[model samples]
Target: MPDAARPSPNCQSSHNAADPILVPGRTCWRMEKADRVAVIIDAAAYFARIKAAILNARHTVMLIGWDFDTRIKLEPDDPMPGVPNELGDFLSWIVRVRPELTINVLKWDLAILKMPFRGGTPLVLLDWISSRRLRFRLDSAHPPGACHHQKIAIIDDALAFCGGIDMTTDRWDTPDHRDGDPRRVRPNGEAYGPFHDVTTAVDGAAARALGELARERWHRATGEMLIPPPPVPAFWPDDLEPDFRDLPVAIARTDPMADHEGTQKTGKRGVREIEALYLAAIAAARDFIYLESQYFASQKIVGAIIDRLSEPDGPEVVVINPERTPAWVEEESMGSARSLLLQRLHETVANPRFRILAPVTEGGEGIYVHAKVLVVDDRLLRVGSSNINNRSQGLDTECDLAIECAPGERPEVCRSIRSVRTRLMAEHLGVSVEEVERTEEATGSLTATVDRLIRPAGRSLRPLEPQPLTETERRLVEERLLDPDRPEPMAATILRGATVFGDVNRTAWRIGAGVAAAAVVGVGLALLARRNGLGKKMQGE
Candidate 1:
């Protein structure tokens, strides 16, 4: 991975930070100071840091994600002599080495259906059951159509990770994003495409706050309230340097709750802090806004962007997304929605300063972007598991970490955020960090810099032109058939689908559509859980 040089401590930007964008109760759940925070750019670096942190755990380690594949290799490129490379073996080995340490793994209950196909995972789970120190559980606390989508890890209440990268197969890829890297293969020895992702690591009170969140989730899923581990010295990786030091990190969440019956529910009520933060951040932008997400189909977010673009002096905007959703069903749903939204943006803006682009490797293979990140002109930085999709807004569970800079405060935080944006652009454009910074300085626009730097051949950022959607696709997107904004009862969902297709109920194809809708609500919940290729069967490899 190429390291972007941090700005000098004395360096500052002309655009002084604006008023705080991360507001408690409105934009975030809480704010806590982190002793150190590092943004791990991709899964390879994140996996390595996680391995080191977990190994340093003195008491408890919690793994929470949409899916978990014990067969996936950690640090495959740089394995330690005599140390386990696969995740399951490593966890077992760590517990045995540190008798005081107890590790717990929690994954969405729907993912259990994929366990049989995952190499050696069944045996690994059996082995985990045999060890008293290692425990695994499935999370089914969500409503029928919703799934637990937060990818998080907490170690000893000292260090924590929260973001889009899951500790599962096909997620490990270096920043270089080499198109044919042999290491980018599954445990079954099948190769996958280049992948891009982002996550943040924090140590201090911030980590402890995340620990509380993780514990709450575990309690909700299993009805087992685990006590917080005693606070200990920070166990951040020795070699890793934090992007921001002694900064306040805000925690944002999306927890959907079903309509209650006559009695009160023990679980917490639904919160839409993530959506609020996105809106607040967008509304707060002055110079520019940069976003990278798995899907760009959120109507609320698109409307926010359109509102900004309609302004005479609105900030320039840039987005990074995959060339196309990897799965066919996802393509028809989220993909079509993305197309519709992009079309609206193009139509609404007269002088377009916004550009949505997809990253590709030197060999021209699309790099699957699974990172959910938002940076608003160095005033705020958000990195987490929530995508710009309806499900993430209020239907599914999510968690995001954000750092905000008040006007004339924390020059270092501002510089760090700028550095992260440049680093991401540099990676996508196949250029050096210095080159990106220089171009941005000259163009005075991130989108313009992208336009100036984009190439026709080698690794480049290609503008994503909206595809023409068929009548069916348009209806699917407009009706929000597959991506409802809130927790929906299964019966209501089916009936709604039936009503939508009732006109053609006699047609054989319409019957197939009904079955597809049923499947999406049933087993298809797994596919909707995460768009990072973990949900469905691999098409070829």
Candidate 2:
């Protein structure tokens, strides 16, 4: 980690030729200085640190995510005796005790469908109605079939967290990720599989910038402008250790251009800073690129990787993904897209310069890899909610925090970047950090080190072999109906009609229109399947 005492004048200077990849308005929204920054691995540590920071918040607490369940306990394994353990109860208790504090939560509106199943969430929200300071709003300010997928939390505009870990059920898991851990259970006591995720926490100017971003999102969703809270003392967790200090963090976003009901749309064009950042970062890799994402189905990203591998001295690439999505529908769509991309990679790259792997438990159960992280050599590190998928590139609302280590500047930052990679590799391989470092030093190749460490048994990274795609699956991947890179024009047209036309039976009309649209899409897909003989294959003919 970089020393706190070291001065970073070059990073603090105005944007110029020093910073290349994190250019504002192109690859990022803004660049701001951070007093301290830490990459919180897994939800266990993330939840605990967030709880601590919120407790210290004096004015505001903003929680934005794809989903939020008040039923889940923040620290199920290690609970405090007097303090509230459940998330809803914890927030409620804070507002009541503080009196002057306000808590605002914004979640994807579609996630409300699951609220009835989330025990105590409705009751908790009902209780919150008594206090005007505690507010909850659903975010539907997105295009049809798009979602607000960024997970973020801001505390008094002094500290903020942005990343893939959502404050919901089945996300809490320690780095150990032991098989059948009793603590890995839902609020209803049902055991869930081990999950791996990451989030970055920052303080100072970067946190303030994130706060502005969160406020903007809230205004768009609820049509209520929020003022920034007065600057407060640092709320850094007592037990947490920062990975970098005195560094400049770039904020990148992916926001689709869509018209909301009550708010003025920003413009015709959408923000694709996240996509630009990914392409530039991938192209700038010198030695290797290490990626950890939930899915690998983006055509642009895959094309960039292919371009790099085609180079004679291109950087080696290593990707980690889940063996397959847990849900059947996602497995068929995203999983099939992955298989096709992998086949293309294999066919184009002559030498073995790239590999995709999945993490496994000691019992050989596949651990879900939900962390969206990218590390290019030892110069750049990105951690956030953006996944390597088509939707994340341009359709979904996403945010990612990136830090770059310029050549001949801040060697400590470079070391910290390298440490992040080694630490993650150690956790996945079930080995100590020292062991990973030693092996990598001995081998002098990241891919070679991984190949040497992975064994036939115990917890290890298993190389994922792409499944042979059937004709139906191949058509699905090529069509990309499930993972379109932009808003579906048909769906958008229907939405605009519902908004522009007034009717007494507005709800019914909207529902009927949605059904008609779905039917049209479904019929087209059915025809495709029939043409491919999928119907007969499914019927066992």
Candidate 3:
């Protein structure tokens, strides 16, 4: 730790251009047939795609995520050509088979700390990098206290996957979320909830851009410049065909230090590009807006939705989230804040059309919602590492891809978009679309379906109401929010504090010394200024 007070060389430069200029309004950009796109509705699809991309990589593999679990199985039960079922085993195999190739992994440091009991696999990944030609490092150069939260993977720099899904364990689930699938297992064989997420695979300019992002993160984390891998033979896998064609796509990034540093600022002092994008999508909606996210807090976005609902012509909004927060302190604190935000939004929107829900498995095996997605007007779709929360806005850097379908296209395109949401519901209920429709049609809307699913002995996987907080819970929330080390301000003050303090103190002697030193210096400066003013006044008299 060489003067942690000094900013890392990898810190993003504010002097640089804010971001690649986005084309104004919606215009269809033609995509190559080979540059196909697919919307992975949940973790199952996301994992399958990852396995496929890995098997297809002919030269290099680059992975960047908010978190990466070594024990995760990229392909749960399904096997890929020349790959093992477990993620860690598969990576080892890949390195062994292709000694000449390079693999780079980057993840946020804070996310690693979130897993208190886990061993230092991240450090192990870094050590592996030193032993082999591969490169791995923990990214902490983000605004002090901010997290590098983008989840992306680039194979041979020819194909890439970007989305909210992470390459972590307990995220795997098939489109068929069976009632008692033996395949679904957690610590001590505990059953995990059905999860829904979305990721996009592309092989064109978008893919190249994602590769650029991975490379940038790698350089930032490791202080090593990575040369782009040589173009590999069979860059695009044969089986992976284009899901759609000639669709225009946009790649957006969030940095707090970017343009308009006021309302967009996050805890890390980075621009909240994700928040901006969500608001834009909400405003652009003409029909329905469907979204799936792990958490829904952020008053700014909730306020935006309420504003839209107040308008005479607003799009219907549907949200899917986990039935309850994870049984952890962080989840409990953040989840309560999110629930409050949702309640505020509910108060503003009168109609029953705007709904937020969680996916529940039949027989009351709690709904474990863990997807992040935003589909707007049935024309534009966005998926990536962002959760619908304040932290993702500016505090943590996020990358998301948006696809705009060409005008007057087939309903199948819209169906493809809707299928992601429907598929999640189908899996949870363990029922077909026809049966789901027959049972849910009378109820109408996802909320009604959730109500029906909650009925006694109902076989449907429904979205349940969030559990209410108790008096003790409220006190805990206040404690976490007021904690000096991790102040949960409505704005991006958390990032400011993290950055300003830096590494001023290290040893136990300087534990609280930094804060005291800052306060004393501030007071002395104020006193000196007042004394100088009085002296000047006396001289004038």
Candidate 4:
């Protein structure tokens, strides 16, 4: 394990040509400095800290998300009887123990409806709602098919957590990515393949910004305002060590051209800061761009990537995604988008640095790279709920956090960036950070480092082998059945219903989507069994 010592302070200045983070009205809500920030990798670390933060909450506990599951145990192995581990029960228990504490949970209305199918009972939601202290609201404040796709948890306006992981089922997993791990099973005892994800814990001003965002979302959805929590509770988690201290953090958001009532919020159409940031980050990459996302179905993002690759001295670009997109219907859409994008991207980039690969377990079962992260030249690190797809870019409401070190700010910032990238690669390769750092230094290349550490067994990055798409999939991609870049008109969504790579966050998983077998594949039955999945909170925040 790497040293838990807190990292040095992050850069403070603005207007740097190289770094795009903390730029007001461009990349973030505002350039607020966090008293402390810890980038927790994987669900185990993320979830455990959440539990600790909630337990430590005093006045307010606000959870804003696309999906929520009550059946999930906050800390399954390390139970806290005082709070009770199960989510719904835990919230209830917290309110009971602390009479002054009020819990506010705002989940997407449709996602709340899909709770039962994901192994959660309606009674659980009912219980939380019935408890006056535990306020629950199902948010339905978007155009049809548009999602409230932000995954955020703010406790007492002091501590906040935001990233890919949701407080739902099937999200917990370690870096080992072991084959058939018993702990990776669902509530029904069915084991899921290895899962990979991340979230950032923050305190001080940054936490307040997240709290403000959550409260604003709640007001937009429910038309009820929540007074900012009093400065009563403590900031930061006691158990987890801070990775970066007193660093300026940017909170970037993406909203469709619609308002809370599905009307135009801005005259221009929609907020596309997420998209602009992607373009900026890609353009600014001096050495390499490493990205991991749930879907690769955005043509505009691909176009931007292709632009970078076309440069005569373009940096290496490596993409990490799932080996398979899960649902056959989803495969027909997102899978095809990936293959087609890869096909197009390959034609533009002549270097082997432009590679798309999947992380696999010891037995080669794909470790779903649901983490939406982008590392540009190891100087800019973005972690959030925005994926490489168009929906996340503009259709759905998204929030991402970015950290960019002003070029020459601190030697430690560069070291920290390299450390973060190496840590991520080491997790996927099942090796220590020392090995990855040494190998990467020796090879003088991220791709070559991964190549040398790449293994045929255990955890490793495998080249994503694009499969032959069925006729149905090809047609779906052609028709834009799933990957819509902008929020479609409600009329279109109501008349021509379709789907894309939605939420597989929290503890929930997306196995399949509503498939038109007869029309698409000539099959009689719908291959997709469940619809508990919500569009993802991309991990790049």
Ranking by lDDT: 1, 2, 4, 3
lDDT digits (tens) for residues 79-159 of candidate 4? 766567778778888788899999988886656446547644677765665556787767655654567788999988888
- Per-prediction TM-score: 0.90, 0.87, 0.74, 0.86
Worst 10 residues of 2 by lDDT: 1-10
Tell me the lDDT of model 1 at 155.
Answer: 93
Give the residue spans of candidate 4 off by over 4 A: 1-22, 118-120, 257-268, 470-472, 492-541
Q: Candidate 1 vs. truth: CA RMSD?
A: 8.1
Give a tens-digit lDDT track for model 2, residues 1-541: 0111122222221223245877888888889999999999999999889988888889999999999889888998788788899999899898989999999888876666576787668778656534468877666667766778999999999999999999999899999999999989999999999899999999999999999888888877766779999878776989999999998999998888632221236665678888888888877876798999999988778777777777777778999999999976577668988988887777667548898999999999999999999998878899999988888988899989999998878899999999998999999998989999999999999899999999899999999987997655665566565676777677664554444333435433444455466556645544553344322222221
Question: Model 1: runs farther than 4 Å from truth?
Answer: 1-18, 258-269, 503-541
Give the least accurate 10-residue stretch of model 3, judged by summed lDDT.
Answer: 1-10
Provide the clash count, candidate 3.
Answer: 13
Predictions in order: lDDT: 0.82, 0.81, 0.59, 0.72
Please identify which of the two predictions, 1 or 2, would achieve the higher TM-score against the true structure: 1
Q: How are the candidates ranked when ordered by TM-score, highest leading? A: 1, 2, 4, 3
Clash number for each model: 0, 0, 13, 26
Deviation in Å, model 4, residue 514 alpha carbon: 3.6
Instruction: Give the number of the best model, judged by TM-score.
Output: 1
Residue 94's lDDT in candidate 4 = 79
> Model 4: what TM-score?
0.86
